[model samples]
Target chain A: MHQKIGERFDGRVLDGGAPDGMQTFLVEPDLIVEVCRFLKEDPELRFDFLADVCGVDHYPEENRFEVVYHLYSIPFIMRARLKCRAGDPPKVPTVTGVWRTANWHERETYDMYGIQFDGHPDLRRIYMWEEFEGFPMRKDFPLKGYKDAYNPFGEDIDAGGRDD
Target chain B: MTDVTILTENKKPGGGSKEVLLNLGPQHPSTHGVLRLVLEMKGEIVSRIDPFIGYLHRGTEKLAEDFTYTQIFPLTDRLDYVCPPSNNLGYAMAVEKLLGIEAPIRAQYIRVMMAELARISGHLLITGALPMDLGAMTVLLYTMREREMVMDLLEMISGVRMHTSFCRVGGVREDLPEGFTERVAEFCKVFPQRIADYERLIAKNRVFLKRTKDVGVISPELAIDMGLSGPNLRASGVDWDIRRDSPYEIYDRLDFNVIVRDGGDCYGRWDCRMEEMRESTRIIEQCMRDMPEGPFQVDLPQVAFPVDKELLQRSMETQIHHFELSAYGFKVPKGEVYVAIEAPKGELGYYIISDGSEKPFRMKVRAPSFVNLQALLGGATNMNYLADVIAMLGSLDPVLAEVDK
Candidate 1:
């Protein structure tokens, strides 16, 4: 099923030797919406399900950040992933127009890693407030969240007990 | 920054310039963990909902990159604190996939048993707490009682009630303890009756039904499109279940039905999970009966610690393998694998990228709670009463630990 759809989009299979056994496919960001639409509408490739939307930062490397979409086909019992690299402002074409679930997932990707999903309707931060300064999940973001003295866990327990 | 002015204008003002932006958490209960929900509210009815997560972000992924394969096992436990064992299994399964090694039959059976038990506990947390969120405090005690038994069983097997890093790469860390079967049998024998008691206590209760029945209604197609999984998706009448459909571990060898209800409401979500607890008990019983006798771990001296006494005592080579496995974890071949399991909430998958190093290149967690939590905005909050928001949140039962991580 992936092969049939991959052919339609001219998607190239990643080197099988890639780490984690992820069968990476490079889909044109523009064609992503159409490809996804076809995948959902096509009978053989009814990937009517969107599993997850996540962004990975490959900093100091070739690709700055890659937005990955995990799709599952119930009828075919197959899974496929689509990826696109966003270098500067970290943007990927939103699939929310195709899958409503992408509304929050794409927002989460944007919230955590500062990736902008173009054409995402209501692209507000899903897991972060509007005032949050920077993306928390970026490799550059510090692990300690918001270095102010106020400890949320301090109300339930002491501040010093929890450790690194 | 370009869109800042547009956002500000659209931000519905709460009470004409006196709009108090109240930070509900980073410590609030409804936020689940340390999620800070910035509510621009006039009173009880919220004007706007801005959920701020990452308060509990421990950088486990970055830590995994620095640590060895074995060292990352314990870290997965913290992701979904409600179901640590499931996270442990998911991580172990991903690593094992990279190494192209399947655990022994007995080990697989034990892993299933542990995972099922964890599923029941996770459901109990949601089921019991949903009522608590609805002001039915008595149900919390009853559900906690059931959860206690599960914790005790976990302690018996893994030596910790929570965050039991019992699951290893090849198999579990320790064998099932003596009389573990009989104890499990005792629980199973009485479990069905307990489930009935719970059903009567809340399933048809007037207040419970009213708060949940039509509240948080998520359509099947919408749920699937939104990436919802586990009981939430099951409530919407989607017959997709990782355990039944995909069948990893020893799940295929057992007989159990995926509990599904078509209401797609908060009550339906609750019903699906309540039925799931019963089904999980059945799976545990089947596991006990079908468990085979064999080596617990795989025969990989490089990854798994060798048990041969002669090698440790007489041969230096055998001792070196054991020392290396413990001190400097084995390197998984350069491969990327996405392995998922039917967790209590949904399809929990671990995507591990290993470049033939002691540390992983990139590790991504397909957390169910994170995906399911999106229902708060679309299904529950936008269409229901303000109080229904709490009921729906509790019903969705997202462990913010998983979401924030």
Candidate 2:
């Protein structure tokens, strides 16, 4: 299916390989929406289900954020993973116009990783509080959060505790 | 906003009224879990529903970054608390895919059995809860009684009722207990009669029909467009089930019918789940009849925990290997895979990315309830009465844990 897609898009595939029986392709971010549109519309490769859309932060990499889309073709009984990258304040075209499920998924990605989805209808924080600072999923973000930040319980509970 | 304008434009000139902002949940019992539905209501009719989720979010995906593949299984158990085994299986399959290994055939059969059992218990709870939400208290009591039996069976095998982290990456935590098959068979024998009892109460009841027959109708095209999977999509006449379509685990070998309906309404959804429970019983019976005797987990000592204490004491190599595997965890090849299974609610998928590290680089759970809850936005609640929204929500059966995962 990746080869077929590659031929149809004139080798738009930046990288292609089967890792652990999962067919994955790295494609240009600009062509992702178009490629997805084709994948859904094409009769031979009707990847109808937008299974998931998530962002991965590759810290220190030039293009740090990679947006991954998992597509499931019901008719063909096949699955494909589409990968694309963006830099700081990462932005990628939203596929919501192609699949409505992308709306929430893109919002979730934006909320967690701070990756902006271009043209998304409602691109607000889906999980975290709207006023929360920083993307918690990013590699650089501390797991316990910043020490000097506001503590809702009034004081740092750990301050009085004995050190192990 | 667009919907409001359209409603006003289409309304009778004298019938135009002020739209009321009604907050349905985040506290209401019918909303199921900590789900908040901000409904734009015109009198009793709901014009739009804006679902405010995440009150239950614990950032399980973010937490997975620090946990090893083996340690991550328990987290999956928390996603869909109703059917933890299904979540465990989906996560296990994704990690196993990355490691390029398969659980032994006996383990696969056992997985099918456990998943089917989970499906039954899950459906029973949903079936019971929906009717109870609609004022049928008897159904909940009856279903809870039956559910207790299923829970006991799960506890017998996994020693835990709700969040049974029974499934491991290579296989199950342990093999089936003695006479477990017979107990399941006994449950299967009496379960159909219980289904009949449920049908008697709600199948043709005028009140049940009145509330659910035509409410929350999701057209086939709209359902597919929204990416609805599992019984919800099947009820909408999509004829797609990951078990039958993709044939995961030993589902292909098992003989069972994928229950589908053409109504595309709340009743259709209810019927699909009810019939599916019967099909699940059938699958479990067949699995038991064709049960094979062999090792449950694969012999990957490096990947699986070294459970054999005797072997660890005797073999120095085994002891060191177990220590290394336990300390550093197993290294997976740098790649990503999305593996989904037909969970009780819908397609429970695990999207995992490994950077040739002991811990997962990124883990995303394609929670069924989270995705299916979008159906409400897909016009499932549009133009319906505020009262009907409860029935619609009950039919959708969104487990807040899975929804807000």
Candidate 3:
């Protein structure tokens, strides 16, 4: 699987060694859409099912955030993970065109981590309301949530507990 | 974001069929929970349907960052309260994967039994509730009566009816309660007859037949394209069940059929869940017989409390170990893993990334209802009446708590 995708994308496909028995790969942000399209359309690697897409907020790291896609091949009964790292203004090209299931999953990733999906048709907040302030899933966000009309006091997160 | 305006030269204000925007809920009962759907209706048929969710959002993933792994189990129970044990099992398995440990064989058996029982209980509610929307409330009363039996068994083992919170990071809270197996065995035996009663009442009924048969057909390709799972995917003729294909825990050892239907209609989805109830019964019966006598929880003291009561009471070292483990939760290895189980609704998954700390770095739930809820959009609800839309939504069975989570 690695050699096949590697030959196509060359240096773009970086193997993210199998963790917990899951085969993971780190793809360049620019190539993710094309790569996902190939994985879905290709006969052998027919990863037709986009199981989930979620964001990971790696605050204090060089690449601050990551957009992770969990793909599954229904016919082959195989699973693979794709990760794309994003910087300060986290943005990754949308795979909505490749797999329609990416529509909601990408919307959710944007809503949670405030990571923008470039070219996503309906890129709007999912779980949170439109006017909600900060992304609650970010590492810097307080655990008690933002203070609004409903919640007067957010949370007293200690200075030491902010980072690891 | 395309808004199509009719430029017909009828020339009269408010003449011809005008598009009416109808808001179905954030409060309506038939929606099952707090879900608001904006329906663009032209005369009687819906032109488009947009589902506005998050009315029940509690930000469980955000809350999980501060809480320890042990503290996160209860939050999972709230996602799909109909089947709390399944949520518990998925979360427990994810945490165990991170910690690089497996629960005892006996505990795996216990988890499978509870999960299948949870499947049965959940199927009963939806199988009944779908018909209830069509003015068949008696089936709900009957199905709920059966659901209570499954709940009684869970309460017997875990001592809680809805949110048991019985699953620990490594394994279950305790062994099966006395007489619990006997009660479940009895339920497994009599439950098939109860299901037949429901099938007879609704399956051949003329009203039920007309309304559900080929009403909301989702093609196999579209079902996979939308990432549907469990009975929803199976009903679309996709023979995929995470328990069977992925073989999580001892499911590979268990013998049960993955119910599949080629009909791909509202009736097929309903009938698929009905057949699954029987499969779940078979699974529960198998777990009861094959379950071996062994430790319920893993022996690892870091993840679970010391198993021996005598050692816990007599030894100060053991007590101190317990205090430190509980008070300041033990650290897990730094890594990330996503573990999905074939839950009643679909694939209930927990993706956890640990920074080698007591609390997880990031925890994301790939909630089945959240993804499956998207199917209500597109042609599934479009061009259908308000009544048929409700039937379609009911067939999908999206739990709002999980959807908004």
Please tell me which predicted candidate would have the highest TM-score against the true structure: 3
| Candidate 3 residue pairs in backbone clash | none
Best first by TM-score, ranked: 3, 2, 1
TM-score between candidate 2 and the true structure: 0.93
Candidate 2, residue A11: Cα displacement in angstroms equals: 3.0
lDDT of 3 by residue, B1-405 (tens): 122233233224766577767778888889999999989877557878889999998888888888998999899999999999999999999999998899999999999899998999999999999999888888999999999998889889998999999889888999988888789889989999999999998888888877888888899999999889989999999999998898999999999998999988899999999999999999999999999999989888777898897998899988988999989988999999999999999988889999999999989899999888888877452227778888898999999999988
Worst 10 residues of 3 chain A by lDDT: A155-164
Clashes of 1: 8
Using DockQ, rank the candidates from best to worst.
Answer: 3, 2, 1
Supply candidate 3's per-residue lDDT for A116. 87
Please state the CAPRI-style docking class of candidate 1: acceptable
For residues B170-253, write the lDDT of model 2, one tens digit per residue: 999898999897899899999999999999987898888888998899988888878888899999998888898888888888
lDDT for B148 in candidate 2 is 94
- Comparison by lDDT, 2 against 3, better one: 3
TM-score, candidate number 3: 0.95
Model 1 ranges off by over 4 Å: A10-23, A122-164, B1-26, B38-48, B380-382
Error of 3 at B369 (Å): 0.4
Residue B216 shift from truth in candidate 2, angstroms: 0.8
Badly placed stretches (over 4 Å) of model 3 are A155-164, B1-14, B381-383
Alpha carbon deviation, residue A10, candidate 1 (Å): 5.0
The digit string of per-residue lDDT tens for model 2 on A32-127 reads 899899989999889988898988889868878999998888778888888888755588998999999898999899888889889999999988
